[model samples]
Target: MAPPLVSLRVVLLYLRVLTVAFLVITVIILSTNSVTIVSQGNSMKFHFKDVYAYRYMFSAAIIGLFYAVIQLFFTISELATRTKNPFNYQLDFYGDKIISYLVATGSAAGFGVTKDLKDTFLALVVLDSTDPVDKLFSRGYASAKNKKLSKHQSP
Candidate 1:
């Protein structure tokens, strides 16, 4: 069996690479598309909007960052709670309970932070009032909400 620490290190390295790649992509797209529009006629009007693609990319980055943090926390918690030694046959199954609490708390914080940031950014960039709500549901929350609703509605 592979050492637990080795596996955790591999996972963290993969996440770091993935995050750097995403950040690079986001910067490239956002910078390349940045523009300003001006309207001068009496009837003309102006509004600012995020490049739609950049908005999506920003949201994805937020989600990815949250996921990476949560994963790292879980890995750390697992390492802390493990009781098995290479030369010892005794193992504490109760360690898993601690891991569970750590995972739950980490996941909640990660998701909440990501959701709040995404909502705020979307509100700033989306000109229409309804666009944020539409984007929120379409991204991932709708499926999660539907699952909860179905659980409650089931007889």
Candidate 2:
């Protein structure tokens, strides 16, 4: 019969796989996002790279993905050999907590940026504008940030 520890390891492996996948998906989504706003016969474009918070979030996701993949490899090796090392236990203990913290901070930064923009610039511009074109402009502005915030749910 499989031991309880083995079952735990299996669950951990599944979680690590999920973490890695989600990080990758989030990174890809953030990379390709762009928004174009037109006001007063002028158009300006913005991208995730244009924002420092989004860049930080992207970096965090990448770092988390790299660590999650390495951890997955280690867990797989441990499961295959049915051997437990003290070093591996320590790493698993600290690594998970650290990565989670990083992801949380990244998500927070993105959320902060989104909220500030939505409440401040977005509201001001959209509310002050009576043009129908400005409504689409407002949606575009919000959509870009919303996409970043949504992708953050994975980790």
Each candidate's number of clashing pairs is 0, 0
Question: How close is every model to the real structure, measured as TM-score?
Answer: 0.32, 0.78
Q: Model 2: which residue pairs collide?
A: none
Relative to the true structure, candidate 2 reaches a TM of 0.78
User: How big is the positional error of residue 57 in model 2, measured in Å on the Cα after superposition?
Assistant: 0.7
After superposition, candidate 1 runs with Cα above 4 Å error? 2-33, 36-48, 83-155
- lDDT for each candidate structure: 0.38, 0.67
Worst 10-residue lDDT window, candidate 2: 146-155
lDDT of 2 at 15: 76
Q: Write the per-residue lDDT of candidate 2 for residues 1-155, one digit (tens) a residue.
A: 56988997887778777777777777776776666666667766777787788788788888888888898899899889988788987787788777777877787777677667556665566432444433433433443343333332212
lDDT of 2 at 53: 80
Model 2 CA deviation exceeding 4 Å by range: 124-155
Collision pairs in model 1: none
